[model samples]
Target chain A: MFKRSVFVAAYLALSAGAAHAEFSGGVIKIGVLTDLSGTYSDISGQGSVIATQMAVEDFGAAKKGMKVEIISADHQNKGDVASSIARQWYDRDGVDAIVDLVTSSTALAVNQVAKEKNKVALVSGAASSDLTGKDCTPNTIHWAYDTWMLANGTGSAIVKTGGKTWYFITADYAFGHALERDTTAAVEKAGGKVLGSVRHPFPSSDFSSFLLQAQASKAQIIGLANAGADTTNAIKQGAEFGITRGGQNFAGLLVFITDVHALGLNTAQGLIVTTSFYWDLNDQTRAWSKRFFEKHKRMPTMVQAGVYSSVLHYLKAVEKLKADQDGAKVIAQMKAMPTDDPLFGKGRVRQDGRKIHPAYLVEVKKPAESKAPWDYYKIRTTIPADQAFRPEKEGGCPLVK
Target chain B: MNAIFGIPTQALFGQLLIGLINGSFYALLSLGLAVIFGLLNIINFAHGALYMMGAFGAYFLLTKFGIGYWWALLISPLAVGLIGVAIERLMLARLYKLDPLYGLLLTFGLALIIQGLFHNEYGSSGMSYPVPQALQGAKDVGFMFLPIYRGWVIAVSLVVCFGVWFLIEKTKLGSYLRAATENPGLVQAFGVNVPRMITLTYGFGVALAALAGVMAAPIYQVNPLMGADLIIVVFAVVVIGGMGSIMGSIVTGFGLGVIEGLTKVFYPQASNTAIFIIMVIVLMFRPAGLFGQR
Candidate 1:
């Protein structure tokens, strides 16, 4: 009996030791809160998770004596669901930072929870300017695109080119409203007039009526202030209804290359839009995009690229501080230094926690212009970082003062 | 004379035309839902997914298989219907004896699984399905330059909606369906294969949704989550129309769509909430629905 008990005890100790080795010795846990299985699932879902994994792997999967662990959960595109998950991750799961929140509403909700928990939030997907504006949090960083960049990239550029008379098909939501308001300001500043506008429900499937009104208005420019599937539907229906052939230009205020690829160059040709990143921008972008496509099976979108850069920068911050699990120290170190990543080019974090990066104005490639799959955009111009975002004093970030 | 709100007549009429176009989709989708619900007693939570799948079917047929929109219009729905048949026979038939809620739950689960698989393959960005070469440009009507595809959608949806109504209301097969709904055991005792009919009926209803989806592909991007957001609004439309009458579902769907369009012109802020507001009013006044017998 004694011999049998000794053998069992020895086996139990060996198993426990292996388990300890797996997670022990200073672990840094990152919670990737994303819309993995909901309305915005296709936009930033599993791709964001993949980007986080790539960042961890690039960092040698460990730094100093610490092993980097990435834990992911689907926010399901609901604010309350995101908040609950974030609360759980902070209070019980030993998570030091959260990244890749996709929707503006969910991002804001998570930002508040991250603030309360004193954890770092590297927001890569949500594009609301308010993340760095009225709703800004000290613990949160708006890492990718925002309303200001989109407004300056598409709205101002078109207005300056003499497509001055404007109408808008605005999505009726906070994010939509912000895009419209910011883009409208940019247009009016460029000596354009707002002739009229229409607000469609978010995720509206039919846009024939809106297009007809746009056609009738005879506006020189028709701006689409929507994103995701709504923008896709509006642009497609706009082509079907022949709004462009009637001498009106269609401007996508918050478009991505994927939307252009979906609309195809035939319908999307000559449609100008602004974005922070495009896969085919240059040799550098193409190199990073090639690896991402190999892993994800699709070209990396601006959101995906942002996810890669945010994760890389956060991991770098962890290494600099040498404290694997210190959220505040790591965040302070991140803001104290400039960010250098292949995806973002060269960027810096401002006082308001806004990541300052050059925004690009890209036109949809003509079908004949695209030589291969995923080659959907041609860069029109580059908006300098200083002009891409609102000035610091005007940003309305309470932490700025 | 100027309008009460001082809105111009031409603009009002233009906006009204827009409303009518939106109403067309509402009517078509709701009619399909009502037909399926009457016999199956199950709210197809996957109806939107099926619709989205149909759009993708048309897109794939055109882009990869070199098929055109017209062929897609016919084959895509049939293809999706076959998928529906398989699902019904393999999975849904087993849940019939349980609470009707099980069918809803099962279909919802199926929707999630299908949508998840598509998202995994095609990320969230919308992909465009091009208009066929023949239907490339617009018809200049002076008042509006109507794209040929839009005209086709409005016209085809009308024909399909009425054709469906005629099938259920005037045909012997529809009589059997109605009878089965009233009492399946009695219909079975009369030497009718009611269970098979039930399965086919569900498949047919699902096929209608898929047809709408295929028709929509050229007009909208074919995205994985396309059906999810549209489905809730459709459910609200169905609820307001009352699942009792097919024609009611069709009319309410179209009427609410037009109202929503008009709201976009007059009160831009309330445009998104207009349909839901109407639903609330309908619930308050006629809880059974505008056309419901109750």
Candidate 2:
């Protein structure tokens, strides 16, 4: 009688599995909203799109009896444009999730619309900590590094290394302010002092005046709390002004592999930066980045790498659920599941929607030390996953129960 | 040992030098605008775009043709100027007799197209143009470490600004250009071939802007949208200078740059808006401008 009951239970489970498969009829569509042809494009543009496609293919959704599609649009780093695209994708195009928003403002804008429309926002390119802080939502997951991660990684390491005095040349915005605030706390906690800081106009082409102020501060380290074209221009012009050779160190608080490529090893050498992923970090990263480079003609930046990891994990959750549910439910499932990917390794999403991963403190390799193309960084230290970001309890995220 | 407003003299001098360098760009760009407005009666809104093109022209010449800074300095302006002549002859001449707003709108549209094309090709991340081997280092002038190239820019700008002033104020071409500005009909009646001269004048003014662009190439990033917003600032400079007197534009460019630099030292936050504030104040006092005629 017990054996008969067991056989009946097994038959019922098989019937339910088939029913779940039938319910998931349509294709899983994802929209990649990013700066495709702007300053951040080299870091998270077509490369990001390609990475998402690779993730979709590698996941083999078709083999698992599901179809997935990826679409993309250029946000142009404008918040309004990003929000509009998100609305259209969710309301009209049946997009289940959006991924890889480059600028922080644009990412936040999309985050709100994603919340309203009940779609997932897997942010990989934007670095603002506010996504998981005051602005955190149940429908969004900040997968990559944030301003907090960068500040903790680079600022603490530099202060520990005896570069005790610092000056900041910050981009004038909420992004810059958050970075400066985070780095200052890290520096002060490590027994360092912030001598001064100057905020330059946003998207500023010339940083000479600000660099001059940083030079005059005579701080042991000049921290550049900016990114994209602003960061590149500051570094290049800083080299021209001989700011690095004048006995003061330059710290790039948030830099990407693309930036180091643009600045080249000669100008970028000896600069300290923090990142969550590097293509040559390990065997798995190398394998994945090599494949990506084949398609994009460049190695994957951390943001691009994060896009792959987040999409792969999202697909895994979808397969586990076996249906395209509302974004909040899908995200809850995502939070419940452990994130394991080749790019970022085994990770977890906090209750606050912050994806936990190890960030690295890296120094750009000098021209002579580089052995191959894209061999740009020498890892100084690894920031553990738990300490890499702000604690969930402190973020004031309403979703963190 | 010296201090101004509690900031060290060294810091003050450093910012002053930077202000002067920026002033040079303002002067050159505004000078071109004023000259073009003087003859063409239309604000050349594409001046900034042409300036950006000038920088890109230098960049392409150096990267593609193996040409160095010296050759780029000569070729970029001439190349951009010729392009400018074509624009004036082909498109701008059509709106000459219409309201000035039409010319403004037409040029503004052209600026967008040019900027869009360049942005499409280059992206917004600026490509660096290296300082020439001749002027690559800084000179320790006891007050601050003055970049040699920055000093060179100021010197060259001063010479160029004065040279243009002389050509317009004292040369034989000056009389025809001024006479054309006052009475193009009369000048044409006198057999001056005013239409061809107008085209060449636009070209000449654009060439001046291109010259500034070439000079700015090594200092700033050679990017597409570099001139889009910068043109707004130069427009502000032009308005404050009244655009009526060529000398007024040059003097106001340098003087306001100095004042803006001082504001940076005393209160860094007001640096970007200070110029616009000054523009408003000047306009309130003199509606035409500091040097503008009714």
Candidate 3:
């Protein structure tokens, strides 16, 4: 009787292994919805799309007897547009998962749509911590860095290291509000004081008035609670307006490699920033980024890198589950299994859907210090994975239990 | 530290200066739009694209040919103006007899195509152009620490705005150009070469937009979408000041900029909306505009 039972169990296991990955219509479709031509485009647009493809190709989907199809759309950094595109992708196009919603508005919008449709949305581009906080959902995975991580990384570092009094030129949006709040908390915790902050319009090209406000506040540090074009423009205009000369330094709360490249080393030099990934961090990163650069001609930003990592992790979970039918189930599996990828190395998706990874605090290299084009950061310190993200209990996420 | 509406006086003063500096751009851009609409009876939606091209022209000249900012200030506008001439000759001239909406659609489509092409090449993060070496520093002017370049921009825009105003309102050729718009057939019968004159006027108006763009290159990062973001605001400025009134555009452009600046100081979040609110108020009150005649 024991021998018969053992043979039966082995046969059941073999059949189950053969039946892994019941892709919809014989394939898993991943939609990369991002800002293709707007303020946040360069960092997360075509580069992100290419990264998603590379992840699929590197995962060897064809060899695994699984077909993966990738499609992309420009959310244009608008919430309504993102929601509509996400609804169509999930309801009509059979996209099992969506990735790389760049702006916070788009990410939050798509997050809700994915939940309603019972599909997966992996966020690598958005920076708002609300995704893992009050808004955390079972059907979504918040990959890479969020506002809390950025504040905990760059904010604490700057405050503890002599940037005591801060005035913020905040973008007038969800991401900006969240960042300002988190950074304020981080600053106060680090024994620093926030003098004041002014909200500016989103994606504004002129920062003269806002910078003047910060200058007049007489703060030791001018914290930029914005990102992409808004941040870059502020930093450039700050120099011209003598905010730097007046001895008020700018702390770029979410500076990307593309933003740094656009600002050039001359202007961006010495600006402190926090990021989840840097291409030249190690041999593994260098090798992967080299392959990426060979394809995209620019180094991958953290958002782009996060997109690749999340897609790979999502794919693995889908394979393990033997189907992509249930979004929550797939996400739970993704959480149950530890994530290992070439971009972020070893990490895990927490119950609140936050991806845990080490963060880096780097200073923009002086023009003289840079050796080549795109050689931007001089990595100052590494924030270990455990200390990088918000604590689960403190995040107000109902899913934490 | 004395306050105005809870904002520090020093800050208020600084904001006022910043507003005027920004107003310089508004005046220049709206002035060009006013001139174009006045002469051509067409809403040239491509003004912003032409502005973008002007910045790119300066960027390319500097990056590729080692040309400095001074030469680019002149060359970019002229070069872009020539492109404007081609546009007028080939496309805009054909739309002269149609509804103004047709001209608007054509130019609007042109703007999209132009912006899309540049965006495909540059990807919209934007490229930085350094302020000229001579104007690289800032001067502490008590109320504000004004960047020398900003001061130069304000001064030059004032001179340019009034210079164009004088040429169009005072000179013989200016009257002929104005007359062509009033009575094109009569102007042509008088051997004024009205067609060529209209084309050159459009070119000149485009060049004025380009000039504003070249000046803006250093203050704002040169991006494909830079002009798109600001063009709508300039249009509002033109509307509020009374479209097609050169002096009206110049005054309201500067005035709205100052009001918007104050909004930045007292209520920083509504700075972008301040102008629109005023536009609504003016529209409800005056219908034609603050200065536009019905």
Candidate 4:
């Protein structure tokens, strides 16, 4: 009778498995929304794509009873386009999570849709602190850098050096304005004075006039409160007009390793900037970066590293839950668990959805200092994870309170 | 009265000089765009890419070929112009009979392909071309320090702008080109090979952009996206200067650049939007542009 009962149970389990496979069993989709071909493309596009694939591969390309399918699209730096795509992915494509959004405008737009739909949005690129602050959403996770990170990295470090007087070349946008404002606070707190500032239009091609004004101000530090192409142009022109050699230091308040690489170390060298990760910082970073570089043919920037870590943690959450799909439950698992990934060592997700991790202050290496083409930065200092991000009490995240 | 509303005279003059330097690039790039548009009727969207290529060509020539800036300045543009000619003959020529919009679309696509290919090879990090041994230092005027490169750029752009203007306005070939633009059929009846002229005109226009790029190499890092961003502003400048007149594009380009500079000095917040503001006002007042013919 016991043998008969065991045979009946095995037959019933097989029938249940067949039914489960027939109804819903294939690939678990993760949609990657990124600025693939616009102003911020160089900073996060191709590298983020590779990072997401790496995460999928690391997960054995399957979760639960389903294979993982990574699908991505270029947001083209448009917020509405990103939102529509996110909505489509959720409604049609069965995308469980959206990862590697770079621009804050696009990230916020996607975040809203994700919250309304209850799909997970992992942001590894966009750097507005508001992602975890006033604009924080329950379903969204800000996995990478933010305005606070930039301020603390560039502002605190430079301020300590008594390079206190500042003249800002700000991009006329939210990101640029926030970076300028935050860094200004850090500068003042460190006893620096604001000399003057100029706001350049987003995607300004020529920065001669702005650099000239900055040079004339004779401020000790010229803060470039911009990112990507704008920052590259400002630094290039600054070097050209001898603004750096004119007794003023060029401070890249928000810059990426790719920007430095594009600017080359000669123009970028001696310009102090802050970042969370430099591919050459340590053995672990080197090892991880080497694999990334070999795969992508480019060094991994912090944003790329963030993608890897965010996706890895997301998968771990999925594995722990033993469910291939379910955004709410998976997100809850993610927040409840401590995060560990090859890119970000060990970190934790805060209640506010801010992933706490260490940030770095790196200087651009001179051309001679670089042994390889992609070797661009040297670690100047490491800001502890606690000190790197804005404190929970000050973060203004409703969830945190 | 001497204080001029809390702004120093020296500060104001310094800002003006800065404006002139920016204006120089504006004039050069707009002049090149106008030259190409005059004959081709297609906005060479790849103009900025060609400019970026010129800079990279100079950088590579210097680093790899042991060429100096002066030689690269002359050679890089020619090299890039030749590439432009090849592109025109092989690809752009096929699109000439279609709507002018097709030319713009084709060139825009070409720009992407060119920029993408370069970015793939070089990455986004820029390569620096050093200021030549001769142009290494700066000179102090009464108000501010003037780097030789800045002075050189301003002076050279002025000469080139006027030179191109003179060529289009006064030369026999330019007159023939203008005549062809007016009525290519009539010009062909006069036994001129209008198509060849069109090809050469495109090449010359591309060469102007490449020349500007070569001049810019020592000033800016050679990068793929350098031209992509600048070309948009140049478009705005072209609209602000009316596309009909060569001299008009030159004047409006320089003038807007100066205004953009002054905006940085006074309000600072309005600097970025100042050019667009002027563009709007020009559209409101003249509709065509400041120098544009109705």
Candidate 5:
């Protein structure tokens, strides 16, 4: 009787082990790499982590018998630092995929590491169009908006509206140069003249000298090709100098909702910019953003929203495979599937790893127009997915052919 | 349209004026650094953090107590000075006998803690402090339009710089302070209360930075990291001016600011590097700094 019982127990254990193997090979870990203490922290730091957690919980990865774990680290917006972290995460920590890289330089660095290590990266925070253009990789997906899309959306819109003569106060860096180049193309294409440009040091507090140069150009619009505190300071000091009242407009090429909030309506009003997502855009966005706000105490910027959408879609691809999938294969599966999330709505990933979604042009409302807290942006029009970004053939991506 | 060296006159003058305004800040900040380093024999790396606190103090005074900018001009520095006294008495006083690098490192750590606290509470984005009604609008000089508040900043900082210069260089108290800087033990033998003088001198030096901060609150975005970067540039200014001489810091501060402004017009690429480049040149010519005494 004892011999029969022992054989029965061994048989049951073997069957259970086979069942687990069929469901998933082992635990899958995703790393959230972003700027935590530096300039981009407000938009992508802790908020992106929270958004990813929400997606993990909602996706029910564990119920499918695949244990998924999340980890995060601060990239500090440096390329070397980001590369080191990516290398360790991929080589040692078994971080299968990384998400939410903020600065473009860092994102580009991590993208190379991901490709070299055979891990996937979902870039939600970085805005350089080069990620999909010349630096395109099968291991990375450029989620959220990019510089080309922003320039095409806001630059052309402003130029078409007769604010034609332009001067650029560009931050002296890769992201700023790309933005200025793309926006200049957009303006010229719309029959606008490029007056001039001044490249200021990054994170400069005094925009007086730069603004003075912009003023001297006497352009109808001063294009700010910078982000974070640099843009906010330019707008604030522009108001102090009465740049707008003197008959010139300020076109913020890359403005976030948090930036608008920081500048407040009095300074930021009448400024027009482009974005991929806004919290109060529709019922679905509002519902998702409201749930996010309940936990984060602020509305979700598009980057934070993108984290949710991409992570959910990534998990879906993993589940469909029913085992730990390779990075390139997982990305291919994700590209094959359509992305539908409450925050961003339904979108598609292209061959060059650009996500297709309708981008919105928004105007900052006057103080009197804001009805409630975080009621900042008033949507003017939507650039349909096909028209939002540059055409595939023009981007020069190797994968496009 | 009149142009100078192929650059428009308005742009040139406008940038020069801006350079002068920036020079005013550099002058005040470096002057304080020179004064503290002379007597204390330690670099107060927390000077920038203290400047940031001064701006926050003024901001709180306005938002919390309905105190206006004019009153803040008086109260903010006093408050920041008191905090500096406490810091000197409790923390900095212990490091007086150690290597000066320890003092610098300790203060640097303190700077990070202070900046982190502000970043946690208020965030990295700037909070605008409104210009006082009495000092709004601009007076157009034919070359360029200069805002009245900017002009006020230039005039007031210059006056304060000169006033501090007079206090340190021309007064009886100044002589004693100078004597103590030479030999505190000898000054103590003369019944000069050397320790008390060190504490007050530190407080007064810190007050100069706070005054600049309160003055700056109206113009620049009052943010946490504002002082962090500016302090680095000011240190470069001190090195160029030679931290030994009061007037060297004052002159170098203003001179560098104007040079930076000029660079912005003729060559926009070198504006940020102009000051540092000049510092490198000056150090090669005069290892003790232009005004620094050996």
Candidate 6:
């Protein structure tokens, strides 16, 4: 009788995934809301749209007798613009899912909008960990990397390697705060100490003054808890100020591939970074990245790779349920299934709406070591999928049982 | 082992030097705005866009044509200055007879268009232009590690700024230009082609901006939005110095850069706003600006 009961439960779970439902409007519309022309454009702009298209084509939705349409727009990295677009897409355009919000402000704003409207938000680009922590919602799945994961992977490594003291030059914003807090935790946990930190206005071009303060603190590691231009500027000026040459190093808490590319291997060499994906990771990634390169002319950043993976996974879930009627239902189903895509393989979404994937710590290659265009990093180590992100129960998400 | 306002004295000196380096950029940019506003009697909002073009111009010359930094210093300005000349002739000249607001609007629109086009091409992360081979390192000068390139920047900006100030305030041509601004009809009666003089002055002002951009390429990322970022601060410097006052713009530019640098030490959060706060104070006390004549 017990054996029969086990068999019955297994049969029911399979049937649930096989459950057939109608496709709303006879089609599934996905909106690729991204930073198209702003600072993050290079990292996650038109490239995201192309990634989504590649996913749709690779999924062969047409051959499967399902209609999947992709639409994209520039968020301009503004919260108001992103939420307004989110409302219009959900209400009027019938976009069942929005993906690749490039900046944290836009992502947080769109997350709320997605929750209210009961649509799926697969956050692929934004770095803040709050989306899956305090701000986790049933309708959103943080599909890419986040601040906590980055600090855990890159921060601990630096500390273990004798970077015992830290001083942070942070951007004065929520994203920066989260990055700084998360990094501080990781640094301390790994037996390092944080001496002091200073916050500069966001998007600040000159970092000399703030950098001097960090320098004066006599910290072994100057942690830059900022992203995009702010990080690059600080690093560049720190070089001019002899920060690195004077026996201190800068830990760029949120460095991206495009940043290394922008700084060039000459300056970015030896800088450690944590990322969820690298195009050259394996045969599968290389093959997919090659196709992406052919289309976009640039290799995929982790965010772009995540967009392809998340969009592919979202489609698979939609196709399984055969409906876009309820975004929360689809997101729940996405969580129920394990993710296996070429870019980020064999991952799973947690109950807290955080996607679980192993993140890699990579060091930027020197100029002489680079073989071709856009070839930037060499992997150092992998933080396992389970340990890569904040532990599910510790996230404080109401959704986590 | 010295301290001031709870900050170390050595670090404060480092910040002041850094501020002076950044201030050189403001002084150069504001000097151009001052000249254009004083002599041309037209506001050139395209100045920032022209500055971006200057950086891109340097980036392209080196990558595409095998040109080097010294040549870029000469070529980038000449090329951007010509574009400025064309803008003055084709668009700005017509608006000169109208409200200065028209000139401001036209150039502001042009800035948007140019910045957008460059952004589309560059993708906004920006391209790297290496520091010239000779200017690649820093020297420890007791108080701070000053990058030789920054020192070069200070010297170059100072020479060019004082050169322009002299040209405007003392030279015979500068007198004719100032006279034209006062009474163009009388200047035209004196056989001086006021329109052409106005065009050249605009070009010169723009070239000064391009010169600053070239100097900045080594220090900052050659990004599309670099000018857009600094333009507002430079404008504040001009306003605080009394818009259209050349010496005033020059002095206030360096002064505010130092003030902002001090703020960075005492209260780091207020550094970006320090210049504007000074502007607010100056405007309140003297509505015509610190040096603007009533």
| Candidate 1 colliding pairs | A42-B123, A42-B124, A43-B124, A262-B127, A262-B128
User: Compared with the true structure, what per-residue lDDT tens digits does model 5 show for residues B88-133?
Assistant: 9999999888999998998888988998899777766667788899
> How do the residues A201-234 of candidate 4 rate in per-residue lDDT, one tens digit apiece?
7766667777777876789899998888778878
Candidate 1 Cα outliers beyond 4 Å, as residue runs: A1-25, A324-326, B140-142
Model 2 regions more than 4 Å off: A1-27, A36-38, A60-81, A84-95, A282-297, B1-4
Top candidate by DockQ = 3
- Model 6: per-residue Cα lDDT at residue B247: 93
Question: Which parts of model 3 have CA positions greater than 4 angstroms off?
Answer: A1-20
lDDT string, candidate 2, B1-294, tens digits: 788678888888888888888888899999999999976788999999999988998889988998989998889999999999999999999998899999999999999889878876665666778889999999988777888998999999999899989999999999899998889889999999999999999999999889889999888778787788589889988898887568878998898878877776676767788999999999999977888886
Model 5 chain B — which ten-residue stretch has the worst lDDT?
B119-128
- Arrange candidates, best DockQ first: 3, 6, 1, 5, 4, 2
Better of 1 and 3 by TM-score: 3
TM per prediction = 0.90, 0.90, 0.96, 0.90, 0.94, 0.95
Q: In every candidate, what fraction of the native interface contacts is reproduced?
A: 0.73, 0.44, 0.93, 0.49, 0.48, 0.79
DockQ of each model against the real complex?
A: 0.58, 0.37, 0.77, 0.42, 0.50, 0.66
TM-score, ranked from best to worst? 3, 6, 5, 1, 2, 4
Query: What's the true lDDT of residue A366 in model 1?
Result: 81
* Model 6, global lDDT: 0.87
Q: Please give, for residues B23-43, the per-residue lDDT of candidate 3 as tens digits.
A: 999999999999999888889
Per-residue lDDT over A1-401 for candidate 5, one digit per residue giving the tens place of the 0 to 100 score: 00000000000122233356332226677888987667777788878888888888778665655677778888878888899989988888778889999988899999999999878999999998999999999999999999999999999999999998999999887788889999999999999999999998776788889998898889999999999889988888887777887899899999988888877788888889899999998898898888999988878888999999999999898878664447888888889999888877888999999989999999989999999999998899999999998888889999888
lDDT of 6 by residue, A1-401 (tens): 00000000000112233334587776788889987766788889888988988898888776676667778888877788889888988999888999999888999999999999999999999988999999999999998899999999989999999999999998887788899999999999999999999999878988888888888899999999998888888888888878998999989988888888888888899999999888888999999999998988788898999999999999999888878889999999999999999888898999999999999999999889999987888889988998999998787899888
Better of 4 and 5 by lDDT: 5
Worst 10 residues of 4 chain B by lDDT: B1-10
Error of 5 at B73 (Å): 1.5
Order of candidate numbers by lDDT, starting with the best: 3, 6, 5, 2, 4, 1
Q: In model 4, which regions exceed 4 Å deviation? A: A1-26, A63-65, A324-326, A366-368, B1-6, B91-99, B183-191, B267-273, B283-294
Predicted structure with the largest lDDT when compared to the true one: 3
Supply candidate 3's per-residue lDDT for B281: 95
